[model samples]
Target: MPGKVVCRDEWLAARKELLDKEKAAVRAAAAFKEQLRNDFPMVKLDKAYTFEDPKGKYTLAGLFQGRKQLIVYHFMLGPDDEAGCSGCSFLTDNLPSSLTHLYAADTTFVLVSRAPVAKIEQYKKRMGWDFPWYSSFGTEFNWDFNVSLDKDVKSPVVYNYKEMEKPFKGELPGLSVFYKEGNDLFHTYSTYARGLDGLLVTNQLLDLTPLGRQDVPWKRHDEYDSKDLKAN
Candidate 1:
């Protein structure tokens, strides 16, 4: 079925009427969600999980970089994989420019992956991204956060607040937020799978188009072909 075609005036009137309801619903839902997020109880973190960066090793606390809040993108780049996941790369490609704004709001953003620092750095360079990235290569950080699965494990793996009967062998994507109060650190929130959709600017923008997302498959920003690049 095709959409109804109407004159400019009629379309304008209908759009305006829909906009009124849309605005009210959006505002109400946003306010309720904001209150729920703000009121969410935080768990105190006492584990001393260490991560490796190009410069040196840092504990979870050091990843905050003196900021009161920290946001870590759990990038799905396993140690044995040749490259990072295309979806994860797309997310990070949109992150560099937002770093300064997040910093101003007292938050530090970083990418964490199970891949070695060298592999992560190489991929970061290939993508031409300058954001901070760290490796949890030999640490329990990824497992603790439920983003990694052991290859030899026979049981189901838990992800996104549920157990998967068959899980991916390696890394998965997620986002975890933490807060620092003096010397104490707390886990404020963590989201996985579709929960990370809020960070995807491309999807958000495409939603405004007449064709919506066009059922297109996502590629890493650097991997798009000439035709796709030109179209974009």
Candidate 2:
């Protein structure tokens, strides 16, 4: 059924009433959730995980690049993947412009993947992204972070804080936060699955429009057809 159409004055009156409730709910929910996130305990990293950057190799602490805070996006680009995950690429397409703001806030953002540095670089160049990306190939970083699943394992794999009965093989997307204090580094938080919805500005903007997200599978920004782009 179609929504009822109302006169301008009537629509304004109804919208204003709903806006008041929306504001109240947003304020209360945001405040409480922020507190919970801030209050979560941090875990000190003991193992020395190394990653391959464009220049050379770097330890996990080096990823911070002198910043007190670091945000790592676990991009789903396995060793055999010809291209990065479409959803991960979609999220990354919206990240380049935010680099300056994140730096100003004393935070460094980077993407980590299990693919080789050469493969990562090729895909990054193909996508025309300048954000820092590193390859965690031959390292336990992805496994320890719960982003990569082992196919040969006989038991259930733990992901998103629960044991998944049928775990996905290969790579999965996630976001992990780390805090650096002098020489010490701590894993502050990690979010997987829909928990990463907060980072998708495109979805947020679409939610404000009439058609919303349209429930279509996202493609890499460059892969979208001209007609499909116009329709959405």
Against the hidden true structure, what lDDT does model 1 obtain?
0.88
Predicted model with the maximum TM-score: 2
lDDT of 2: 0.90
Q: What lDDT does each candidate get?
A: 0.88, 0.90
My TM-score estimates for the predictions, one after another, are 0.92, 0.93
Q: Model 1, range 1-232, lDDT digits (tens) per residue?
A: 3368899999999999989998998999899789757777899999889899889999999999999999999999999999999989888866657588899999999999999999999998998888899999888899988899775772567889888867567778999999999999999889999998878888888977777888788898777789886653
- Quote the positional error of residue 3 for candidate 2 in Å: 2.9
Q: Cα RMSD (Å) per model? A: 2.0, 2.0
TM-score of predicted structure 1: 0.92
In model 2, what lDDT does residue 174 have?
98
**Model 2 Cα lDDT, one tens digit per residue, 95-148:** 757588899999999999999999999999999888899999999999999999
In candidate 2, which residue pairs get closer than 3 Å at backbone N, Cα or C atoms, i.e. clash?
A: none
